[model samples]
Target chain A: MKKILLALSLVMIGIAYHNNVKAQSEEELVQICTMVAGDAEYLKDFRIKLDAGDPPPVQRFPVVLKKDVKYRFSVCNSKDYEGKVILQLFDNNRQLATTYIVATGKDYPYIDWVCTKTGAYHLVYSFRDGKAGLAVGLLSMVGTM
Target chain B: MIKHRVILYQALIIVLLSQVLSSCSFCSRQDVDLSQELIVPDSVIQNSTPQVSKAITDQMMQNISSPVETAALIKGLKIPFNKNFLASTKQADWFNTNFEKAFALGLYGCDLGYLNMYEKTSFVVDYISVIKRLADDIQVGQFFDFSTLKRLATNNENLDSLILISQQSFNRIDTYLSETNRSMLSAVIVTGVWVEGAYLSSRVAQISNHPKIRETIGEQKVILNFLLALLKVYDNDPSMAKLITDFEPIKKLYDQVHITYELGEPEMIEENGVVTFKQTDKQVIEMDDELYNKLITNIQELRSNLLKL
Candidate 1:
């Protein structure tokens, strides 16, 4: 019985330690994602951890966007990450609609687009520089007009 | 006698070490058969960064299907909530086991979003209670601020607040599950939501000839494939095995779907000194009516297996 108890206690300790690291990463993700989400109602967030590179590979999220429906796209990068992230929105025909990375100085916080056509669209994101970073991408609907 | 005690202690330590290694894989799965070990390496899981095909990457990017977004879209289209498509909250208690509760949590999450979208305040309470109950049962109850959620649901007018709070609630739950190494629950909960959402979408598409809805269902072929791969990570569990069995044909149906890509010239625009670039890649999906009917049938079939279990 004593041996059994010892084993059980060790297992608990291991689990507790594992949870601590996971929690810290998640906390960072939530804080960053909330910034991109802004005042718009939160929908979901994608947490990306970049490996060392000139440019981290782009991440893509596909959703069915409707015509005349306004949607919000935002990005939040970790402080340690070397640079910002650029988010691009593409229509079914592969036409770029509103892209945050290319809009002006490549430092805009988010994209608020009123989709003119309805179909499948991709929300693509990548770190501005490949210096290995952690970032969160957020998506929300601003309600239809 | 002391020597025997030492030997037993050493054996116990070995057993405990194995448990420690596998615990997060579903450490406390009392009722689940443990004959098959959960075997997934950290390196193989692309949960943090998916470098797969665009189809597979989009599916993983979702991580959790946006039933709430779907609800919003339906509302934007001026469609009424077809309560018939939703699983009943009355069945909440029927999901007594961990697997059942986790799966049902996904199902009810869909119902809750639909209810919130329609501003069906009165119906939200029972669903919230059931969701709380399931979350509590799974030991992730702390993530859901039930009282605050209930208060938000009761107001009826703070639609935006309610949406935000609810999104935060699920976000917290998912994060806690990930943080605490309860990824199995996360997997099932996500699968449950995806299955329910797909089921709802497929059913709605059947009732109406909405092109967008049909396209949505067709597009799910990509997601369904990725979902199957995620399930393979847990294929050792009996419940997961059953799920894998149920979802196989759905995968085969989706295998028939072919999406073609046509890349157009990229355009760069300068507006008010803001530089924006547009992707010129267009995709054309070819799926026949027979395949569509088969796809709906398989999607519904998958959900039916989920709920019936």
Candidate 2:
């Protein structure tokens, strides 16, 4: 009976180890980014300089929006891990507009704002513990009533 | 002895049934003769550069003038496309038709069919090169130097040779359609039409705002329109009608994604001889996993049905 119990314990340990490895791999695939806009229709293009340790960033094209149109921006991880990302928005003079903390992999976390002003803005998105990378793309602005 | 005889009879019956079921060679003497007659000219044979045949050009013009006859010809031409798809159990008929039509329309090589002769020849290499080059050119970073329109007008011998090689390679793909594979073919045709149509349509939308890009966008529209029309026909098929109904929601999603490609979304402002307008990231996310999986399932079912046929 003792020998059988020992074998069962080993099997359980092996399963746990396998699951842990899988969870780690999943955690590595998470990606996060922040989008900022001066107006609802256009997202300002900002430069992203990845640290040497960061994974190669994937490029995205711009999403177009009309003036006064509500837009939402979110960050997502490709892996199974549920983590949090921070989004910081800045005006042309580098003044803070909004700061948001988004939970990744659930509830498409993004900013919903209508453009009252039309111009360029900068958005900075940072991830926790170097777990995710940032993606930048284009968006257009249109005049809306 | 009686039992042994019965067993032998059963075996014979099974063999006969298998033979009858397996035989799929439907090519008639006419088909063979037509294929044989499709001979390339010496110039075309020596150099892969497609030499436009005046005879074919005239014939094509005449056929185009007669809309009814042209439609009939297109319908008839679709037979080999269908047969090959059914036989090979590969939904490659749509691709083959595009290549064949392009070639027949003086876009590829000299038209052999104008002489009332069909050539059992292959232009796989040329077709592949043309497709690859076109795809590359349209890629985001100018991966290929020549655009689709430019490739159509390419007069270089080396490029022509490459195209010819590609066309030849395409011939190796068996396109014989069987009853079992029909469903599979239907699924593939649907998927191909959906993807290609969406791609070209979005590109058209992207260029719609630019006067300079209008011509390129128009050409893309033509291709997209053709793909959509083809999809409509397949959707009308009674046996595979369910697939089309199922695709309606996905098609709507595709349209939503394409809306992001609208041309007027960007404008140019000139200030002190410098022109700059607001540029935002435009990206369309792919269909969700559930939808994608459903589509894959439908395609697999179609494939399985075709295999049975």
Which candidate wins on DockQ? Answer: 1
User: Model 1 over residues B36-66: C-alpha lDDT tens digits?
Assistant: 2222212222222223332232233234466
Please give, for residues B214-241, the per-residue lDDT of candidate 2 as tens digits: 2222222222222233334445555336
Predicted structure 2, TM vs. truth:
0.21
Off by over 4 Å in 1: A1-40, A46-71, A76-106, A112-137, A142-145, B1-64, B265-280
- Cα lDDT over the full model 1: 0.66
- Evaluate every candidate with DockQ and list the scores: 0.18, 0.01
What DockQ would you assign to candidate 1?
Answer: 0.18
- The TM-score values for the models, in the order shown, are 0.67, 0.21
Q: Pick the candidate with the highest TM-score.
A: 1
Question: iRMS of each prediction in angstroms?
Answer: 10.3, 24.4
Candidate 1 A-chain TM-score: 0.72
Q: Model-by-model lDDT, in order?
A: 0.66, 0.30
Distance from true position, residue B7, model 2, in Å? Answer: 62
